[model samples]
Target chain A: MQSGDSLPELAPGDLPRQFTSRAALQQHLQQLFPSASGALSPIVGGWAAAQERLAAVDPGAYGRSRNHLAGAVTHLSPYIRHGVLGLAAVRDAVLGRITRRPEGEKLVNELGWRDYWQRLWGQLGDGIWDDQEPLKTGHPASSYASELPADIAGGSTGLACMDAFAAELRATGWLHNHARMWLAAYVVHWRRVRWQAGARWFLQHLLDGDPASNNLSWQWVASSFSHKPYLFNRANLERFGAGHHCQGCPAARRCPFDASYEALEQRLFAVTPTPRRR
Target chain B: MTAAPMTATPMNSPILWIHGAALGPANPALVAWPGRPAVFVFDDALIAGSALSLKRLGFLYECLLELPVTIRRGDVASEVLAFAARHQADGVVTTAAVDPRFRQLGQAIAARVPLTVLPVEPFVAPEAGGPQPGDLGRFSRYWRRAEPLVWQRFKG
Candidate 1:
């Protein structure tokens, strides 16, 4: 990596094309984009690294275990999102490797989500920032706070799981799909923050922060684009997260997510009952 | 394995304007014109207004470093136009971007020079003589239309 720096390039005002180390790159970027803060993520960005990741993807395993925090999920979004790896190229790679439809179907379906979001963006333009439908969470949109609470933003929220997700997001610029769902639900439902606030916070740090995916997904959890507000219970979290967050969680005794779905629905939302058939 | 630098064949050939949406070697504009002098700009407003963090900027910078593009930062349209003038480009060629800001910049650049926007290869091309991304009100509805089409091109 340092080799490119030794060349003494000729283009005027062109920032150094190489760095002696990741630290050096970090230092240079700190000076260059002074407004932007935080340490560089361990995730390297380039086709070389991208190809290596692509090679390791196991579509079958991905389909089977993607919801687990330590699942065989492909870390392809940063690469795919930036166009370093085209969606078609990835699909071809998966198709070329799979012998049966089931092996690749979930992976392909996940790819479709990206395509769906982009297509939606083309149709909606900037309107992607707005909710696609009315909220189904049984609370008025006005009920949600307009900003993210400082505790959540600062990653000091007492719940070990949410704090860890917040910390990982800021430090790595990435999060697992389940963790993202959990965190979004916590923000919108648990904390009563507006989905837009969380969406903007995500875009500020996420490497693959395309507004379509980020905003729409946030809306999905907030029940503005889905049939119901997505929620997770402590049992579900412990089951999938393998007790990592709950092993010695400080809030373990009084975990807000500890309740049953029936209880949570009653406690968290204002359910408007449907009329009975006459 | 065989191609010539397009600069020799014509005067005012389009220079590629690489933006955030398409930062890789496989970008349609880069593929369409091999060896074309290319430029990438860090949009100042996005950096300042969005308050993008170092991770995002660093990642983008690293990606740009891997590609054979001249890198700069400032008003995207202005930087792209200046790069075009520097190369004596007749037009600007770029991959289409979903971001409206990109479209606005493309329009700005096109006001001074011809601009060409190439489409990205679709994840699932619409069925022949079928609805154009119709009924996107829900993913299930869209998937009902797209899932089978996507499987059609699967080689294995």
Candidate 2:
């Protein structure tokens, strides 16, 4: 992985003309990264290494291992998020190397989701804010803000998975795609924290923090953007994070759902229904 | 030269407000004002173009039409002074700006009119409740059973 310090700052003259296409952008990148070593040595080095690893590996393994908290999945989000690697370029490179299959299509769909969110942002400038429901009127026992600092930054939340996520997000500025969904669901449905607070916390810490994806994804889990809400159980946590060694999760016994490892494995690995906009 | 006596003013002129975000969520309180001034929202194309989003520039032009009370987009203070001189406006009311230039504009406008910068809280999403074991199993089953139908709809 490339460290933030290793990347060189480009002058105005170095930038490409506006409205450059993906192919043209790639050509520009090639010129920019001319030799094996350049000012962008870190980016080039990271991209080359990632591409090599991606080419040789079986992405099917990703479907099974993507949820594990350990180093079980590829970390391509940062590279893609920063515009260091264009989506089209990555797609072309991946397609060239791997046979197009259901698993590959799923990965591609994930990338397409990123594109969808950006386009949606362009379509709705502030409507995203407009659709927001006001915090329940009349004083509730607690406000979302009260729990935000501890659950997000302090990582003092009693939920084992939630605390682990907070710690990891603070440490690395990244989280697995699935883990993000799980975290958002747990926070909104289980912890009852407001989505906006969670979104802001994510943005403050995430290196790949994007307004469209982060905001909309939070909305989706909160059931604000969709008709139905998403909820997770303790078993779901155990299956995905067995190796992480979490401590004192609140959901262990108090949870409404079963926490059995085998039950969770069957549920998570099953050919499940894809998420949809309600 | 002898100055003509100024006549007492009639009712306060309504102030038209323009913004890029949705008025309801961004500024709910504004909706309650009795003035109920006309609102002109710029299209996305106008807001997204150039250094300043088209929406912002459109807002500037819209404010110009309501000169005197016209709330200028940049350097609120100067814009207010300029509008006051040109249109003889009663006063300017405007929302706060994040950009330094706009913030300055607010200060400038405040010099002339009764500018109010309303404070607001941002919206947030709620957390998920931990589901029961049977509910978890049901949700999983529901997800699996619905996959084919959802995919078909997606493809369509």
Best by TM-score: 1
lDDT per residue as tens, model 2, A1-278: 11222222332222322223334434443453332111111112223444554565455566456666653465665545433344555555544544535555455555555655544554454565433443221223244443455645577755566667777776656687667887786566445576777786776556556566788778767656654455555556556667343445564555433545334334432222333311
Off by over 4 Å in 1: A2-10, A272-278, B1-12, B129-131
- Give the C-alpha miss distance for residue B143 in model 2, angstroms: 19
- Per residue, candidate 1 scores C-alpha lDDT tens digits across B42-133 of 88898888889999998888888788788888888888988898888888888877777777787788777778787888788756732255
Alpha-carbon lDDT, every model: 0.83, 0.44
**TM-score of each candidate structure, all chains considered together:** 0.93, 0.47
RMSD of each: 4.7, 18.2
Best by lDDT: 1
